[model samples]
Target: MDYIAENTNFKLKNSAVTLGKFDGLHLGHQLLLEQVISLKKQGYTAVMFSFSYHPGNLFSKKEFELIYTEEEKLAKLRNTKMDVLVSYPFTKETSNMEPEDFIKDVLIGKLDAKIIVVGQDFRFGHKRRGDVKLLQSLAETYGYRVIACEKRKYKDSIISSSEIRKELKEGNMETVNEMLGQPYSILGEVRHGRKLGRTLGLPTTNIIPVSGKLLPPCGVYASKTIVDGISYPGVTNIGFKPTVGAEKVKGVETYIFDFNQDLYGKFIEVELYTYERPELKFNSIEELKQKMQEDIAFTRNYFLKLNEGNNSSYSN
Candidate 1:
């Protein structure tokens, strides 16, 4: 996919665009993406348009963390059939743009959108004055069609990014993964740690998350680590290693079962499956090691049952 971020000088032709924050790219967001991608057969460029900053950041004083960072969002979209991704700069001026002006300048003028896809409740431009009705009203004048998709539902509630963030913060991995349409994964390069795990004979691969990346509560999780495109089940600890140095920076550290290979500086994706236990501060290194062993056993069994039909193994 072509990523256009902060740079929008060029225009795309015959595009089918979907606009949204796409923060988590949850199942709800996927519905919009699928709509745009479906237009590829009609000779339209599939484009996903979002702002460089979260739209809510303009009105709130608190820092906004994303379930998927900008890089992570692009990474996820690359796997799809979509052709283009736009992270348009969001400034005070753009936020105040009139609804019709956004459509004229962005949708038709810049993107040359032949088809516009959005959720039923989609709104835009100047105190959120824009709505599906407005977009539809101008469709004839703008020479583009509008596709308003219904919101995806999970049981009684709507599948949304806010709800997924809530479930993630509460350490409900199962529910979060279900709504996400895939496992909640942390993607980063394996960085060097203090080698404490190695000394304890439970060596791990560590990844320092990027700034503004939202994470679940610090805990041990039954996870699957993807190394070189192959997934291996493991136990991951997402915390600040309070038992050892009590590092100030939180990190994702995973011990791939039956795997022994150098991974420093290599990129890996750790997918959380189940929240196992809370992070604990042990008095001794032996105590921490013992607890880790128990976590590993539990995680192994969890994956075993999860993949019983496929005859999964713990080995890499």
Candidate 2:
């Protein structure tokens, strides 16, 4: 993927582009991306216009949990096979530009967009004055095609980045995974922990995810961990160990069953598949160990049954 940083010596001539924040690259964003990809095949170079920061983050005091980091977003866009990725810095000066100026100066003048694709609810420019209709009018004047992608709905709900974040925050992994086209994953490096699990005969690999990430609710989850391109089924916990009288800060720790490998200081991706149960305090260390054993057993059975069901459906 070609990365074009803001204010850099980079320019594209006559490109087909999609404009959006594209936080999670959820189904709705994917629809617009698909349109852009289709345009690329028709002899148009595809470009994506996105801001470095979410617009709301600039004005609002409350921090929003992002589904992916900037690197992750670029990776996702690369999968769409876009020819160029244009990242516009979100500054007060850029934000103050009028909607018309943004289209004429940035989109048309800088990128030279021959075709533009966006979602139905897409908006841009100062105070978000540019709507789909405004974009269409501008495209007509500039001799470019304007495509508005319809909203995507799944399970009677709009598949939006905000909705996906809400689902993840609520521990609704199943729905979030469906909307994301894969399991929601956290990419991080394995870090050293207190090794309490090791004392219990269940050594774990602890991970400290990047800041501002949307973590799943504190609990045990059936997950798949990938390290150096190899995947392993595992049980992960995202919480403070209340039973062992640990601190209140959040953490993600995973125990991969039937696998032993030294992974300290290595980057890995942990994909949450399903929510098992919430974190709880146990009366005794023996009780906690016993419950962990049960959790592992349940996870194994659950995956086996799930695979069997998939095989049966395929046979049918």
Name the candidate that leads on lDDT.
1
Query: What's model 2's lDDT at 65?
Result: 80
Runs of candidate 2 with Cα error greater than 4 angstroms are 6-9, 78-80, 311-316
**Poorly placed runs, candidate 1 (over 4 Å):** 309-316
Clash count in backbone of candidate 2: 0
Distance from true location, Cα of 3 in model 2, Å: 1.9
Error of 2 at 65 (Å): 1.4
**Stretch of 10 with least lDDT, candidate 1:** 307-316
Pairs with backbone N, CA or C atoms under 3 Å apart (clashes), candidate 1: none
lDDT of 2 by residue, 231-260 (tens): 788899999989887755788889998888
Q: What is each predicted model's overall lDDT from 0 to 1? A: 0.91, 0.83
